[model samples]
Target chain A: MFDEHENGYFTEETSAEVVAARNAKAEDERLRDCVNILVKHIHAAIKEMEPSQEEWFKTIMFLTETGHTCDDWRQEFILLSDIMGVSMLVDAINNRKPSGASESTVLGPFHVAEAPELPMGSNICLDGKGEPMLVRGRILDTDGTPVADAKIDVWQANDEGFYDVQQKGIQPDFNLRGVFRTGPDGTYSFRAVKPKFYPIPDDGPVGKLLRSLGRHPYRPAHFHYILEADGFESLTTHIFDPDDPYINSDAVFGVKESLMAKFDLIEDRAAQQEAGFDEAFYLVEHDFVLAKG
Target chain B: MFDEHENGYFTEETSAEVVAARNAKAEDERLRDCVNILVKHIHAAIKEMEPSQEEWFKTIMFLTETGHTCDDWRQEFILLSDIMGVSMLVDAINNRKPSGASESTVLGPFHVAEAPELPMGSNICLDGKGEPMLVRGRILDTDGTPVADAKIDVWQANDEGFYDVQQKGIQPDFNLRGVFRTGPDGTYSFRAVKPKFYPIPDDGPVGKLLRSLGRHPYRPAHFHYILEADGFESLTTHIFDPDDPYINSDAVFGVKESLMAKFDLIEDRAAQQEAGFDEAFYLVEHDFVLAKG
Candidate 1:
């Protein structure tokens, strides 16, 4: 079967085709398709770039260093994918939701498996270093029906732009992280410090690539949420503050128009006191709509 | 400049454009072009594959594992590039020579810096295993003129398909490796054992990928050669024996019709005696042509 050519070796013109043809008898159909498309695009890129041997070696070294930088606390390859906007692209391709449904974004490498569960309106900020803020949101289906008994997992960086996990000893455990359950009304609220824009780890190969490309490593100031309910597709998304300077230039290309929230400052003492803040505070009200499974 | 869009965030339709736009101000023109093309093709692949989150994560894990497998002696990422035919493609792109010139293949990951220089007709096989073979080659320029004093650095695996470096203590040092200089006639000759086909390292991520793709890991029996001389472009290539079963399906895609050589078995006792062989032997007569610098 392989004797079609006297010396059927690789060539630039048929490189991708040859590689893809080798997968003709793949055991898994999905694997075959995945490898075929991957090889095709890789060869396309190579033809477009015509990278020299040195350039190719440089890429291999960059990948090796990126992998070496990853451990239990760091995932450099994910950061590479995120910085290249591949993560966001994949997410967008997979999550084609209804018009009114909330858009999804990249699930960054920072989510902890078990965050502390708190009651509604409980403060998540333990350091008290940032402006107090109140966030209220309702979980609803695309049909406008409330999603009862939904769970909202929220986490964010402090005003100093550092997550609790990033500054382990300095920040309180589970700082700016909490899980809240929605009532039968599908409403959930929580109080926490305003999130801050922060740079992704820039000391590794991905950072070097960002610098070389004249791009910043800062993601926009935002809060992360993982909302799940029965009979609805789980939504992993971010709520960006409109005031953030990086909103239009998120390093990871994770910003979405539907996910931006307007933060309103409450100067009136009555409103602040009603919100349980002793002074002026900010409030963000946004609704999340999930698609039915 | 980043404030052009109210929500100028990334979307599926504009992922690659958004990523490439970030490099608009790159100081290095080469880096800009490289990143631009890379980002464009990466997004193209993602769109074509539409990989699910699990599939995407699986790719990340595979890359990380490929990276982790690299150390001082091993480079699995290079192996990945090799088996996918990227290495040979890059070589072909970089080494475009005139008609009738010797074509180049992958240098592979096994060449050492220093090979023992031997006089012409010296035997490179120290272990005295397998069938004895003699290789006679002349180095010539593209214009057909002999390249005098040309250096031919040659290396190959034993009949068992293992290089001396792969089995250090078991095999004599530099058992199948030697550097020979051409005389005024631009001709060189050396004695060694016949080469054999071998599988690339298959215990790592690249091997797993090959298995999943239903591709074998075997490369045809070949002798590696790097020919160099004054005023000529150095050539790194291989001479594959046409009789090998895997000639048309080299695992690394390193085979080329122009590089194949026929191994003639010499059963005549007088010829064997003249060639310093006690029994029957094989002979390979191939000439290499180097392009002018």
Candidate 2:
């Protein structure tokens, strides 16, 4: 039905329309809409950039290398999306919440299913490398009602800024990862080493792109959380350490003002002993609010 | 210095800006400009689409598959660009010539270097399975002056829609492919079977995408050419048959109205005998104009 062109040839002026018109017979409406939007935007971008043939080939090569860099463990395309701020943009678009509820961020490629469940006061730092810290938090609904029994799954990098999965044999299987259930008072406390700033896996094409753009690949120190409760929406987010150098310039743009938690150092050995620490440590307190599903 | 972001955090509203700001420190100005433009367009597309998290992941998966489908003999990403019309768009943007000059199109993935050189009036149809055709063309400058000794390289698929390179044993080496030079009058002629419409190498991700978009993988029957001379810009393009069903819907979007040539069936046995053909044949005549370098 798209026989508008008597000669049916391509011209620069109608390139996108010609391509989109070919989809008139597409059986899937979603596919048609998606393809149309994609073609339109791609054409717009090409017109804006006016890329030369060589530059176009360079893009193809970069995308090919990005695909080749992926394996069962690594996803360079995701890294590309993250560094481009696309992941966060998609997350933001998908998760528009009412005020007072915690905002969500990217569920980075590092999360694993079935993390070990632990008591509220359990320590997740099996490495014992960085300065000890205590994190205590409450789970509440948007209107201030307690969300007891909420499952809080957390994970983070160690002092060396390496995840347990990254240093498979060196770090314990579940190093710096745990799942805790909020108590009846909606309170949950965990002891662990302070999170440290870390560079993303930068040995791939995405890393090369970041470097070429004069951008760093370092993300601020942060703890990952996937909080879920019976009637509340599950939240995948990060809690950033306010003192980290990259706090303002996270490589993946995972930091938010509401997600930042202050880490206060405590010099009192007595207080540390009372909290079951053998030496002085730091304290971080922040509450999380979830919206109804 | 991209330290304009006192907070250096990515917000949905400032996502593209934050990414573009990083390029302020790029050493290569061209790279900086290209990257800035790319980031702006990509962010604009994302905001316009507002793709869901699942849809975002689907895109990543598609790109990864497109990359993985490429190897030494094939480039699926290029095919993606070709079918999407991006390759032709780039070519048009880069090769804008004056109104009477020959327009360029995509140099498809099938061209090979070092085709056998032949004198004018040579027959390139080694296998000879289809109706024989004579192609006589003159090479001229945009001013209509002769451009003698211009090298004309041409190749096309056989009657079964397969290139010699694609079917090494079935067809003779370099069948339907040759290079010729214009004589003092800037006239060259060669004999070859009429080219048939051919499907692109569509057993990969690109093919799957085309199927999903309700687009066929068949390009119009056409002859590929790359003409060059000492002081003129080389032209890479195609001469498509006007009667081909896919002429208006070339899978690669490579067809241009000015490039379409009519193939006239000639029933004159006398002319066929004079041209050394043993049966009824076809004739195609066209002229090519090149711009001065």
Candidate 3:
């Protein structure tokens, strides 16, 4: 006895279409489009999976728990996005640089501004807790022209696989993290420990999902970089150590082939003397190429 | 310098495929498939929407807020599903019945297990705050055979569109909610107020989403029912008032054509006497045909 209507009722077969039609009245075109696409995909997913009522309830609870697991100090939803690779995909879609420019990746949560900006060749390894490495790099334009006076902010985890903030009193402040200014020659060098593979924050709903999916939570060892210069598009990326164990399957999918750097070991007398090292150390020399703004 | 692998890296073009390949190791086949489908759709949505980082961040925060809004008292995720029409789809898929059998609908969040059983013809409208109505129906098998001693649990919002639980002490306990059993001839009749359209609990993220999408949160006037009988599947359903304003656009998408029933106003002296009403009352005759378990 229902009256004939334009969009009709929400039958399973016409559900998504009906919703899209109903949402035609939405004022925000972008939001309406986004909502329609999301609704279409989710409906397809449910139709394909045909999850039980209990399974649906479990998903609802999982989302609720994921949200509950987040607080002022932690964000479980971002973790969920990372594990699902949406974070990287979003970065990729948003940061499609010129072919030769350094690729952007996840900035991560550990980065802090106002890092101590040191002169060329200064050591950033305040604690000296891991393999001593010299990170030297030049900031260049996409066409390979060196850019003078570029600011390169850098940070990484220490040997124990923790940021200074995570370890607090256990690690020195700004350990394995600092900023460097490129000289007129567009070259900068700094000393820090070789980065080590580390597990992301686990023991949350995202962690539980990772375990359930037969996935590991470790991100490949890498140094975080945020580069900025005049009239150029700033870049946020990581120079991943190619040899790190989790390099192939980064939990957050943050790795790119062009971003991979060789951490070469050097023990020559001259090199050791220049590095001010008494022992052989890893040397990571990676350059960044920025796109025009 | 990265090693060659089966699925390659997580590039935007192959992001979903790479994740599906990586998850091939998942032990639970069903969960793995579900995860793959969900990831595929989400990636597609992101690609289509290409939400800016700020928009994505807003989404993450919205989800976190939705979760945080949930405690022992409320579930905002379920509200999100309802507004998205996912809840009704899930119920429809899970409760597919035999041909000619009554279709099922959302049970909603207000159902209580221990609703006091009342005799047929007894009034369930404890508050008597709405238009009086006599509900008569036969519980029958699919072949039109009467099903004796069938349990019919019923509940509805009052004229003010609030469930008893929602009003607490303001409305008498068990207002317009009760259980009844079919007699030997499978005939059952009861008196209750005609349900009024109501907005779902909306002071949360789901409500914000509805307002954003230019949709209202009101469900059409309807009475909820859960019917049970021997050798047949228990049915959860609703009888929609065909003339309800929101019938075509139920926020939860809970209505179906076959579930619509006519609510005729009967002012005849004899019918009013029979309904035990001194004023005009609505009369609804709807039978439930159940499917074998």
Which tens-of-lDDT digit does each residue in B1-293 have in candidate 3? 33224457789899998888877778998999999999999999899899999999998999999999999879899998887878988998888898999999999998989999998999998876878999998999989999999999999999999989888999998988899998889999999998888998888888888889888888999999999988999999999998888888888888899999999999899879978999999999999999999
lDDT at B187, model 1: 89
Worst 10 residues of 3 chain B by lDDT: B1-10
Q: B259-290, model 2: which lDDT tens digit per residue?
A: 98989888888998988898888899999999
lDDT of 2 by residue, A160-241 (tens): 9999999999999999999999877899899999888888899998888878877788888888999999998999998888
Between which residue pairs do clashes occur in model 2? A248-B8
Please give the distance, in angstroms, between residue B104's alpha carbon in candidate 3 and its true position after superposition.
1.4
Q: For each candidate, what's the DockQ?
A: 0.63, 0.61, 0.58
Error of 2 at B282 (Å): 0.9
What ranking of all candidate models by TM-score puts the best one first? 2, 3, 1
In angstroms, the error of model 3 at B202 is 1.7
List the candidates ranked by DockQ, beginning with the highest: 1, 2, 3
Per model, state how many residue pairs clash: 0, 1, 0
Instruction: List ranges where model 1 is wrong by over 4 Å.
Output: A1-7, B1-7
Query: Can you give the TM-score per candidate against the true fold?
Result: 0.96, 0.97, 0.96
Instruction: Evaluate residue B57 in candidate 2 and report its C-alpha lDDT on the 0 to 100 scale.
Output: 91
lDDT of 1 by residue, A83-194 (tens): 8889888889888987788889878877887998899999999999999999997899988888889999999999899988899999999999999999989999999988
Please identify model 3 stretches exceeding 4 Å from their true place.
A1-6, B1-6
